[model samples]
Target: MTLFRGPVQAAPAEPCNTFAVPTVIAPIEGPERVVWEPDGPLVPWQVAGADDLWVEIDHTRDLLRRFEAEGPQPDRIIDRIENAGHLVVVSGPRQSGKTTLLHKAVHSLALRLDDRMRTWSNVEQLVPAQERWTARSPQELSHVRVVALAGPRNAPAHVAWAAGRPLDVDQVHDRILRKVRETLGKPEVEDGHPPGSEDLYVAYERLSRQLIEDRTVLLILLPDFGWGGEGLTGRFYRSCRDNARCGIVFFVESRNDTGCADDLRTAFGDELGTENVTHLALGPMAEGDWRDFIDARHRAAIPGAAIRVAAEVTDGAPALLTGASVGKLRKVLYAATQHAHENRRDEVDAATLRAVGRAFEVPGPDQFRRDGASRQQTEEPRP
Candidate 1:
């Protein structure tokens, strides 16, 4: 027994590296693999590692969908029109997605038309052409035609023409008619009619018939119509009143000034009594819609990363919800997560929210301080 137990060698201590307990280490030379635990407080290095977090978040699609759904409810508009002809004016604050909504409505209309036409036509060939037509000519009619006088620069020119300013309406009308003829692959008709004349209306009617024999639906997207003056609004209303067969005219205006609305009402006051001129005021996005948008953006940025904080920071403004970069957004979110983790919160808290907001370098009112408010009165709010 003494011989057998002569040397009870101590077992060699297992290497420290092979220990089962977790080891937190700083970055060292050579290939170092690091795994982070969600339970621990976020280290500054961890926050720094998420530098490109904002790159993952994109709320553009969500914002677009919301604007499309809320603004141009075509089915509702069509239903309303069943009883009486209605002029639905879609107005909103500048850059509030009015033009985008208009385009979405046009897209939906094209899709509906395509679905109905698929029953008869070669669906493949028709589909591509339909898509092209949606962009090229939103309003395709046999009897009437629409000329979209839009584009930031051109709209002002059209407004000037309508106001009987230095610009000539007849020339502008001829140019637009030529553009339409070219678009439809029809031979350009002579500029035979004078502006603001009965013949001008006749020529438009004839042009509409040449393109399509049925009644034509014409939609003129006159954005910032107020820029030209009160006279421009009056001229547009009169044109719509006179040209029933030429389809309806849609006037898009900014909602910043009640003056625009007043001008429009005054322009169409008489017509409003006998004809259907309706005003639609588009308000800001609903709180729920904004939250969903923020959540979507957060998921997009981080994939599986929890977005408990970014949503709180955006506060649901569509511009802010969709506009910030993913990396920046992620930094804010990571900071928020870290704050929450340290505070032993299962979810983000108000302090965490404020921290996230601060991380974004959001300026206070004083930082945005401006002088000469009276000087800014001359410039119209940007659309």
Candidate 2:
């Protein structure tokens, strides 16, 4: 994880994923208001002003832990996209940090592809000396272009793309075409050419061939992807697949609750059967990990608070973490921090969390345990 600022105090370099308090937060004047505002699909390090409350602690272990317990690591998914040149379906319960993992992968890829990082005279000052731009595979691509789009969950058919709404099919096509034109320049249309006669395919074919020849990778990320019948989504996927010759990879994100996984399986059964397409389902992590994450987030939010959050506060709040998505966890933490700020508390306590949980309808510890036990008894294992 790249830290946002210079270290005020040097701490012992603990092994990756350990809760060693990697970066010291400088004290802030007056009152601090911290919120986890997501700046699109870009990682915090890549986004300007998004690292105000950022900490250097690596949450990769948390992700890896979840993967080890629930599905294959994200590296395998990336490998399928990059090495095999296949589409990967990444499914998880909503708020399972699917975008977070993908953003991390893209950030690392950007770092590796940036030759300027190696050529800079003050490279150590710009990038941390400890940071490694290690190549993941032997066949390293020199260039990359990432186009991120999310699937419309409950969008109206009339809407194209709006501030909060996902992009529809037409908008998706327009965005892809715009990217192609920006990269490869506009193609001239013949004077007597008919409308929609192989122009789109020709453009994509040119894109595919140029990327292949230039050793550039085009990664298209489609998160929150749901199945809209053949006319809607089927044509979208089939069209891209038909035109893409090489150097194009798609990362499709979907919620497992929806029949999106089955839809993808049916649509691309051949690729799946051939192991060219892979699906990774993300699940929640252990309670201890959640506790650590909460503590880390708290420290990052407040900087130099008097004390860390009480452990029992988290231990007793399984309702906030158990089977809860990372999104919910962040919300709970955000509310608790706000509560602390409003109450002028140095550290978030049980009272602050309790009040926050009440607003979010989180159950008490006993009720959470009972529910967990019930789930264990009734729930079937996932294939």
Best prediction by lDDT? 2
TM-score of 1: 0.48
Residue range 1-383, candidate 2, lDDT tens digits = 22224433322232121111122122476422222232222243233222323322234455434433443223332232343344545555445555655555444444443333222212232332222111122112235566554321211122334564445554565565664555444453112222352855555556665655554556666644333332345444544444443556565655443344566556565654343444555555455666666665555433233444666677675556554545566667666766676787766677777777777855333322212343333222321
Tell me the deviation in Å of residue 102 in model 1: 2.4
Q: 362, model 2: CA deviation in Å?
A: 2.5
lDDT of 1 at 266: 67
Model 2: worst 10 consecutive residues (lDDT sum): 15-24
**Which stretches of candidate 2 lie above 4 Å from their native place?**
1-45, 48-84, 108-142, 150-174, 183-201, 212-215, 225-235, 238-242, 256-258, 273-275, 295-307, 315-317, 363-383
Instruction: Put down candidate 1 lDDT per residue, 304-344, tens digits, no spaces.
Output: 23425433445534333333322233344456666666676
Q: What is the C-alpha RMSD of each candidate to the true structure, in Å?
A: 19.7, 10.1
Q: lDDT for each of the candidates?
A: 0.39, 0.45
How many clashes in each candidate? Answer: 11, 0
